[model samples]
Target chain A: MHTVTVQVVRPIGDDIQKKAAERSAVLLLGCPQVPVQTSIALYLLSMLRKKGIKGIIAGNPAARRLVEVSDPDHHYVGEVIDIDRCVADLAEKKRDFSLCFAFIHNDAGVSYAATIGSLSGGSLVALIYGEHPEDVAETLTVPCEKIVVKATHNPMPLKNKIDEVLPWVVSNL
Target chain B: MGCLESLKYEILLKNASSKESGDFIRNHYDEVHEVEAGYKILDKHLIGIPPIAVGVEGDYVIFPYTKPCYGTFLVRVAVPEEVERLRKRSK
Candidate 1:
């Protein structure tokens, strides 16, 4: 069996989503790794961290900001995208990654992540509401699930998000 | 992460739960169609509707591929306005 480690994160608050988007957009300026609006990237980043996969982020200032949320210790920033490349590079290994987890606080972010996930392949997408999420289902063509999130409000708490969904991912993936 | 329903719908498609399938989809007609673009609530023609990957964000939904992909052909059920337009054009 082929197995690649990935992480899932959900920053469950409004301000965090906007900041993450703005931060990602800023990094996306000339970067080519992936779109800054890519919610899946953020979600996948978390998964990468959990499984201790080699990771690299496209070089950019915004990526630096995302480092603020993704890797506060700052060690993994440069390693982010490199990790995905390494795993994708090894697609012939055995079994590819099955699921990724993410925390979203808004509609725009959700669309970006899911769209990118679809582009990549069959990936899972989740949105963590901050108590009041905008209901915008008219735009999606992917299956969605609803789950509860508990937080002291760190927003996109990577490890925390994954633990909560591990059961579901294991069952589904 | 959030938008629990979107996650659940995605799960359903991946591993269909026969019991809660369209009934839940039907109950949330306005909401479902809004998120599930080109999706109508008629049971009779469900078989005809192509199964494209779908995901939802609150009330709005998104379909992945932009152009009509070659291998698959889906007869999407557009909203009433678009349906009317198609009807008018056909006649």
Candidate 2:
């Protein structure tokens, strides 16, 4: 696993409360069918934490475990949630997230990201990877931020993209 | 929960003939009715993800699941024990 640390920079004075209130994000993971999914998820979460954003990972049971097993020290992955329950919570308006970072590989993954973006009324960023990414991006009609990284077992490609886009992700959110 | 304790809940079997049971699952959980043949592409990819529920039939169980990325896939569960194990581990 790649070791990346986040430096939490808190704004001083009256802006502190507003920044604190805004320091929340959802780290959404697609099905952990591939090994890289887990790695990419952790990397994104770590970067988000560095930005002073609290992140909770939501995925299928297997996907959640991927993150857990990948991080024995419990440093990057702070919280893991069942995908269905998380969607239900979003649907019911129980948790209004500020942003959703969804790791997608296929069409279904695209749908999940769009749905979360729609439901939470937050910024939806589609971190699309895997085969035929262009086709997958074409299929996506829902308005969202799309970051494309082509890979299967390696997380480096996506990590580089995240480094470049993290600022944009935070600024747009 | 152990298998026996888990068995207390409903298991949607692979060859379950009861329309009522199918209807029950549909009504209760997030369901995607009739996944068209064209959409089987989505189903093919879903095999990699974890299922939401296990449907136990006479000798086997099928996975009854819905994902935000795709529709419902009531596919045969190849490894029920693994699914059960993962469920327990998650708990």
Candidate 3:
């Protein structure tokens, strides 16, 4: 009779701790005047969550409410934080995010993205969308990855871009 | 910082365009933050940089008021409602 002995190796100490330290990402969204932007944001939130990245939505009161109401189950989104405080904290280095995705559709969005990209020492992607996303992208002078798609009423283009870029973003993290 | 003054009018300096005013505010203020379009400062939406310096001294909310031809002026307005809203939002 031949007996086989098996040794099971369990990850301990640093290895387990490293795996437990899940990376966090912040979705910096602006006040969307159109419904499509909100739709795209929700889609992106789902994708981020599926990728195992903890996503925090930072925006104004209305924008925050939009996400809260849309994702009432909290299935895809995490804590909804104030964008102003988020930016201040990032600048002060009090809060550090592994990745940042700024949904830029207007000038204010561009400014927010530029500010966050400069402060956040992580991968930053300026997802520019709307009527003339190119125009909005031009104002984003900060050196960061950008995905500009003319998607005001249609969410397909923006959604596709997100799908394409998400893998690269996760790899960077 | 003294007793609250009962002034109710806004001071607008329209000596510069919106872009120029925004640039000026960004250059001048070290801690400027972006406010949404409909945010009430002095019973009106600020036209300068979306990001503006908001300071509180006593019961007054000090911010930059900008108009096309009037440029930008660091005006303090006594609007407790708006001030309270800002305070709440910041938290």
Q: What DockQ do you compute for every candidate structure?
A: 0.03, 0.09, 0.08
Q: Who is ahead in TM-score, 2 or 3?
A: 3
Q: Residue A34 in model 3: shift from native, Å? A: 2.3
Q: Per-residue lDDT tens digits of candidate 1, residues A1-173?
A: 99988886666786654543332211111121222223434554555545433233432355335454655676434343322232223232322334433233333334333433433333444544443433433333345453334322344543355557654554443
Who wins the TM-score comparison?
3
Between candidates 2 and 3, name the one with more favorable lDDT.
3
For each candidate, report what fraction of the true interface contacts it reproduces: 0.00, 0.13, 0.00
The parts of candidate 1 lying over 4 Å away from their true place are A1-64, A68-74, A78-102, A134-141, A144-152, A155-161, A167-173, B1-91
Off by over 4 Å in 2: A1-18, B1-65, B68-71, B74-91
List iRMS (one decimal) for every candidate. 13.6, 10.8, 9.4
Q: What is the TM-score of chain B in candidate 1?
A: 0.22
Q: What's model 2's lDDT at A81?
A: 87
Q: Write the per-residue lDDT of candidate 3 for residues A126-145, one digit (tens) a residue.
A: 88888888877876777789
lDDT score, candidate 1, position A164: 76
In candidate 2, what are the lDDT values of residues A65-169, reduced to their tens digit? 778988989898887888766766776677867888878776457556655665677888888888667776775666788888777888788888889988987
- Please estimate how well model 3 matches the true structure, expressed as its whole-model Cα lDDT: 0.68
The top-ranked prediction according to lDDT is 3
Ranking by DockQ: 2, 3, 1
